[model samples]
Target: MANIKLTVEEMKYMALLQDLTGAVARDCIIDNENNRIIFIVRPGDAGKAIGRRGANINKLRRLLGKEIEVIEHADDLEAMVKNIFAPARVLGIRLAQRNGRKILYVTVDPNDKGRAIGKGGRKVNIARLVLKRYFDIDDIKIR
Candidate 1:
């Protein structure tokens, strides 16, 4: 696990999430530029974090006035990357070193590339941020 530091607002949001859904949050990323907050909940808690009919997440979105995306935490980097692109079928990942930095080349289902990249590349940016923080990955390239 990485050494995660939470800001006051993040801690507050996490507390609110737990209170609302009874789910344990492993990490929280505040994407102000995108007007959203991403929460990585404990393994096996994704469904709880989302709640029945997505009621919990919907409530949080309304309460925070920001979009809420909850992802399940994974024990390994490969799984974490996969989780980051959930709903988009990832075929594989190739790890390579360059300039003494680690980079990831991800191959996903051709048809879902746009979805994986997301609107205005928001999803890819978030994936880069999360992977850089947690795994020291320098960058990612989608194939």
Candidate 2:
């Protein structure tokens, strides 16, 4: 079996997420280079983790004193795509631009692709919005 190691911020994020949502979060990561954090949990748990309109998340941002990003997992294709582009969840992200258009491409665990895209592409849309705003990307594509 392969072992996965987590950084200090990832550990802290797990602690904070559990404290807020009482859910078991996995695959927590902190992108020191980008100054962001990411984790995985069921979509149903997202509301609790984020709080009412993101109140808990706001608190985490203040406490961490750095930018924070969350990726809610679902067990579907579109949801997985959304998860992949979630700045924090993306293990390796590459940006490509053409004709004044920007495209954000991301790679995620094969098993997680479905959950990232979500049902009927709802999650994908939301993730696209997030990527557009934060990364200024015109489009998000996952593999």
Candidate 3:
């Protein structure tokens, strides 16, 4: 696992989230440009993080005034990537070593390519960040 440092704002949000959902947040990403907050919860805690019928997430959205996305963390790299891109199915994931660097190639359903990339490539950027932090991936290629 990578050592992720949280900003003051992110730490505040994480504290609020833990108090509200009673779930441990493994990672938190504040995507201010997209008006969204992504939280990666501990394994088997996704449903708890979101609450019943997404009530917890909705409450967080209303309180924080930002969209809330909850993802479950996985031990495996491929599984974790798939979880991060939920609703937009990933066809496959390939890892390659080149020039002493590790690169991750993700294949998404052609129909959902746009969504996988998100507006202005935000989702893919997030993917790259998360992969780099946790898996030591140097880059990501979404296909």
Clashes found in each candidate (C-alpha, N, C closer than 3 A): 0, 16, 0
Q: What is the lDDT for 141 in model 2? A: 75
For 68-131, candidate 1 gives per-residue lDDT tens digits of: 8888888898899889898899999999999998989999999999989989887798898788
Ten-residue segment with the worst summed lDDT in candidate 1?
69-78
Please, what are the lDDT tens digits per residue for candidate 3 over residues 14-127? Answer: 889999999898888887777888888898888898999999999999999998888889989989999878778999999999999998899999998988888888778778
lDDT tens string, model 2, 1-143? 12466678678779877987676676575556556666666666666777888788888888887665566766544455445454335455677898999887777667767655656654465566545534566887767
Candidate 2 vs candidate 3: the lDDT winner is: 3
Ranking by TM-score: 1, 3, 2
Best by lDDT: 1
Q: Least accurate stretch of 10 residues (summed lDDT) in model 3?
A: 122-131
**Candidate 2 stretches greater than 4 Å from native:** 1-3, 74-78, 83-143
For model 3, what is the error of residue 43's alpha carbon versus the real structure, in angstroms, after optimal superposition? Answer: 1.5
TM, every model = 0.92, 0.52, 0.79
Computed on alpha carbons, the lDDT of every model, listed in order, comes to: 0.90, 0.64, 0.87
Regions of candidate 1 where Cα sits further than 4 Å from its true position:
none
Worst 10 residues of 2 by lDDT: 81-90
lDDT of 1 at 141: 92
